[model samples]
Target: MAVKTVKILTDDIDGTEADETVAFSLDGKDYEMELSSDNAAALRNVLAPYVEKARRVTQPARTSAKPASRGKSESGLDIPAVRAWARSNGWPNLSDRGRIPREIQEAYIAAGN
Candidate 1:
């Protein structure tokens, strides 16, 4: 089966009765489809399942081993302490928003007890 994609653009003009013009390109051809509010809602309903499926396919599966090791490594400091120390020294990218990055972790370990 061939994979097909739809690209859409929307422009809204202020104080207009029909404010939205949805321009979409399909099969290398461009066209504008005007939709009422109700139709737009219906289109969203139809596309919701495919959009969700695409999201699932794009995400990777996680393994049990990674989270376990990330909790605490062979290094003396646990993850939180390493993050704190990194911040105190004015280290770049100190936040543990995701996992503490590898370079910061290496710097922390290199500093030693």
Candidate 2:
């Protein structure tokens, strides 16, 4: 599934600060960093609260499910380029030349590559 939006909530239970006062902003916008500039350990007291809050968040739900179709996937039926050629040549509906589901015709053109 596509993630369209995100909501963030941070809490400080132990009066810890993740970063220095450099995190404060004008309109409730704050930046709390987990790693220091030198890639050293962060101040434990500061980051613990945000970490706990993060753990509370629920992950998004799973999306589409499809059962295994034996040999169908191996047939290359879902190949995007092959599908494009078939659709472009009036496979969905037979043209006046009456080529429908133009897989074999497409293979002749593309040599089934």
Candidate 3:
């Protein structure tokens, strides 16, 4: 016996069959949606002026596994040190891995550390 898998894309806006998936970003957030040709064209038309005027920024290539130095934030602060300070100061339940909350980062800086 043989089986085939079929994938269908429905337009996010109007529930019609989609021709393609559109990817966009706003306010530092990434988003993707399946859109029919008409809706996709409309979206492009609306954003054309802004897109023409906007500067394109290229993202760094990603690796499958994070490097050991990934703990450092974009601001170049030592994440391990921040975690240690947070744990000792007030955030005893802070996780050992993953991103540190923005509030904690701000507080760490505010405390002159």
* Model 2 agreement with the true structure over 5-110: per-residue lDDT tens digits: 8533322323343232224222446555333322223444566686577635455887688566432334445544454566565555534332224555455357
* lDDT tens digits, residue span 9-104, model 1: 333322223434666444568777656565556666887797678533233777767445655755545877887888887785666665677778
TM-score of each: 0.33, 0.20, 0.60
Number of colliding residue pairs in model 2: 1
Each candidate structure's count of clashing pairs: 0, 1, 0
Error of 2 at 60 (Å): 37
Ranked by TM-score, top first: 3, 1, 2
lDDT of 1: 0.64
Q: What is the lDDT of every predicted structure here?
A: 0.64, 0.46, 0.93
Worst 10 residues of 2 by lDDT: 17-26
Off by over 4 Å in 1: 1-70, 73-77
Report the C-alpha lDDT of model 3 over 26-95, residue by residue, as the tens digit. Answer: 9999999999999999999999999999999998988899557766887788999999999989988889
RMSD of each: 14.8, 16.9, 5.6
Query: What does candidate 3 score on TM?
Result: 0.60
Q: What TM-score does structure 2 among the candidates reach? A: 0.20
